[model samples]
Target chain A: MDSARDEPVLDVRGLRVEYRGDGRSVVGADDVSFSIGAGEVFGLAGESGCGKSTIANAVMRLLKPPAEITAGSIRFQGRDVLALDGRELRAFRWREIAMVFQSAMNSLNPVLTIGEQIGDIFTTHEKLKKRAARERAGELLELVGIDPGRLKAYPHQLSGGMRQRVVIAMAVALRPRLLIMDEPTTALDVVVQQEIMAQIRDLQRELGFSILFITHDMSLMVELSDRMGVMYGGRIVELANAKDLFAKPLHPYTEALMNAFPPLTGPRRELTGLFDAPRTADSCGFHVRCPDDRSDCSANIPDLREVAPGRWVAQSAQGAP
Target chain B: MTHPLLSVRGLTKDFQVGTVFSRRRVRAVDDVSFDLPAGRITALVGESGSGKSTIARCLARLEQPSAGQVLLDGEDVLRTERRRASQVYRRKVQMVFQDPFGSLNPVHRIEHFLARALVVHGHPATGEALRELMTTVGLTEDMLQSYPHELSGGQRQRVAIARALAVRPRLILADEPTSMLDVSVRVGVLNLMRRLREERDIAMLYITHDLGSARYLADTTMVMFAGELVEGGDALAVMDAPAHPYTRLLLSAVPDPERAGSYDPVERARLREAILNPTSCPYGDDGTCSRTEPVRHIVGEDDGQPHWVRCHLRAPASDIARRVLKATDDTEKAETTAA
Candidate 1:
């Protein structure tokens, strides 16, 4: 477990990404910064178009034209990730940091066998022979708790949960330092989702690899993440251990999001879903939706400052923290 | 008491797949039965291919049931051959599907599409009627003029809901209505559906894979597994303490952020079999428990709701099962509310 504790696996600093074309520009990510410790399951939580997924893409260097990393420094194992291109970028992808794209289960090639798809990773990355790659793929399938006999099964042959597990198996096949999973189980059922997450968690503990798990579901994040970063309107508004964030979210948007979904096993309460998105004129992006919005709160966008030893929050009202 | 708004008995649907020569019968919906009383929300919760959607389709008359009886106001809607009675039955039940984008016509504006449903369904197609329906679902005059593509996912879903309400249906069958929407907008739509129940006093059968949302909106929760009703009771109780082996597995499978509960290694190995194996006792693959067909065990009667688990493992012949069943309710209470 102490394999690499002193140094963070991923160190993203003051990152900025912009989507610009046709005389219009929108901030995809706004000077976001975070770090994932070795073997830590760090969850990034946010809604659609909130810039969480964009950050994942930027980290993987998969951003296309019209969506550029305006200004940012991404370091993996203290090596500059943004500086990599050509042969280095290819080396960095699976061998260093693998990713499970959003709805990756459905993204599987329908015609390809699950084994063939996973085996391709080994063949390309490690230059293993076809038969050897297939053997390694079967081993990976067994590692993810799937039957090795099902290696010949096509994408459509497996259930949604099975398909999702195959993707996870492939992502972890190379045993990368950081595995980025973007809403990995959003498509699966409740029962199967828990099972798949448990599989990932088990694999993480066994292999000791850090994960940047991304999803909008708060409850799911709480179950699996060691620490979490809450994203809103393209900025990481709050960062804390899962317990603190769930119990007491300091940022307004974080608090609002916690109240959005009703608890399954608790006493029922009313949720107003109060407030709207902050106006373009308002300096604070969440001012429009804040139930506790003040004139001073709308004056400036707050800086993400450490409030405690490990907790951080972006709130103008909190007075410099 | 008034009769149930809608009642389904031994509902079953089978789909034919594979080549014509080697055709296989996939039992999408097994012998499922449930009653939808007025103003009460009964949630049919299951994974994909659990037959919850098939039951909903049969109720909406979108698909024909292989064997079953859909009784509305004591009339067998499925058996009804008369056009007038069928029309009345169709008017009483309306469906809202999963994808709001795919459900709406891209070529038509919001107003025209909704207005057309009214005319085709024999409802008043006047401006006042359209305006009233739109207002009920929280839509305004401006949204009506825009195309479906112009509206957001939540707004488009609201439009679908408005169209369902256009016919003033007594029962609304919503099949995964909020799964495709964003997380923030999901609660808003669920809140809207909750408000509609009180406002319209309409019975709704919500089909969903997410139990958290099901617990939020449903008064009664019904757990479906392998195209069979494995458990049914009050939502709170069922979610809190699911009795059936399948229901317990389903509830514990929910990835609760607060509780990363222990996963059953043995169960995880047999996960796919639990969902898609078609036949086999969920408790254990044994001759006694694994019958030729699905069975519903009348576990008990408590409060206004009666808790029942459809598992051969808890058969009536077992003394312990009988004792648990009898402890829930006496014969008198069962007879009084047996309708």
Candidate 2:
């Protein structure tokens, strides 16, 4: 991981995405800020509707009308992502920053061959000839552990894991500096998921690309990420080194999220399931569900503060390092 | 010793794929057998196409097995009530489907769905009766009047469980009940299922790919692979010291915070390749896997609760056919004795 402290591959600051409808706007992502170092894996983890995907969409500039980026800037290698125009944004997407969605395997066109799909990325962005692009496609397929012979195979012909590999092959065709994978292997089988994660890790090491991996699986996020942010109720409540986050999570919500699923090997214990609660503006967003909720939590909102060198936590008090 | 609430023997299901001319039998569930004891949660853990769900469907009488004996409470339901399941059998065994959203009628209120099940099962459809059902699953009385869409995924699943309980079932086959739900709310449903087993003593067969949750909720865990029971034992013991190679592989693949950064791709690829060839043995290609059925070998036992594995590696290379026959006879004798 050749990370440079000065220049990050991607920098998202004060990002606030809102869904404006029926004369009211609901915050999908609120005041979120994070940066991915060069050749580093930065994870964003939260359950459904916690604005984790909203942040990913915002970074990719994929947010449409009704889903507005109300505040903040996204910078990729010091380039303002939000400022890119039609052609610049078009060139910026696959060439600079590529995204593999949650259901990216199913996103493939059934009619196109795997080779043809991978070739299309090169032909459109790199302006390579069809023959040259097709050759390059074969190399990309092999890079992701698929046989080059299967380049002629249709999307439906491939298995779920193979299809996802094809999607990943296409995403990295232009050698993007940043790859945003949103729950890339959630739908996959456990063993297949492990294989895919290993492949991704190998690809990142070889390609030297930063990954913005997003998922609700805390264990997976902790395993893959160098640094991660824990989101709750559209706000990033905690951010720290992955191992630190897992070993000793400061935020109550982060702790709850980790304990949500039972360990594969452990003594039987009660799992605390989180209740869905509306975020209170004047108080801590997670106070409703927080087991360590104090009476003062309802009076003051907690801000994400650097309690340690690399550990950042959002709590009113008693989160001292 | 008590008789199992449900005992499945040699259950198999085959589907015809391809064109009519090219039609051939594709075995989905092949000679799978298991027991669901009273008040115990038996988790059938497996990946996709592993036939865990098929067993659940076979038990619920939703999918008729091509071959098998579904013995319920010492009586064979398949033999007695051929073609369609009796209303009594239907009431005794209930199914909680995977998708809560798709399972419930979006057009109707939650109360209507619960009341319909109650009326069909000869239970009172009164408000208090409905409230009792809701309370059993830890839902409020007001939620009964709300539509399915009005409730969250977890709430809707509880309502589905409420509907299942409305029939006063003795056994529940929940097929990946929490797979479609969000992570934060999944445990609530699992805990509710646990409470049901504790309070109502309702036997359950939880079919899921998630090993972690299976270990958490189930008393006995059965690992299925390629339509075969590879391993079965006490939940915690099996998860802790997995005997079967396939079970070990599955456990290795699980994302554990304790085992982070220790992922070995080379080993995983080897195991995956070895296990994927469903026709061949994982340890070696001695033609034994393709030749004969692997006899169940008792690996460990705690107070007579045996941990068993169906693998050529574990089982001695003796007369497998005779051993399998002997094993079947022994199980039958034991079951008959219990009955």
Indicate which candidate wins on TM-score: 2
Q: Against the true structure, what is every candidate's RMSD?
A: 5.2, 5.3
Model 1, position B84, has a per-residue lDDT of: 36
lDDT of 1 by residue, B1-339 (tens): 567988889898999998879999999988888899899889999877788888888887777888988889877876774223466676788899999989999989899977988998987789888888788888897788899999878889999999988878898999999998877788888988999999889889999988888988999999887787879988887888777876776776776655468546467446447545534544644432322333566676555798888565565555333333343434443334332
Tens-digit lDDT string for candidate 2 (B1-339): 567899999999998887878988878887888888899999999777788888888888888899989998989999999888999999999999999989998999998999999999998899999999999998899987799999998999998899999999999999999988989799999999999999999999999889999999999999997777889999888889898877887887889767754555576556545555545554745444544566689889854578999876676544443443454424553333234
lDDT of 1 by residue, A93-189 (tens): 9888999987888889998888889889988889999999999998999998889999999998888888889989888888899999998988777
Q: For candidate 2, what is the lDDT?
A: 0.85
Model 2 in CAPRI terms: which quality? medium
Q: Model 2, A1-321: lDDT tens per residue?
A: 333456888889999999999988888988899999888999999889999999988988899989999889999888999999998988888889999999799999999888888888889888999999999999999999899999999998888988998899889888999999999998887777888898899899999899999999999988899999999878888999999999998877888888888888758898877766656656555566656645555644467888899888876566332
Interface RMSD for each candidate model?
2.1, 1.6
| Best-fitting candidate, scored by lDDT | 2
- Pairs in steric clash, model 1: A219-B257, A222-B257, A223-B257
Measured by DockQ, the strongest candidate is: 2
Clashing pairs in 2: none
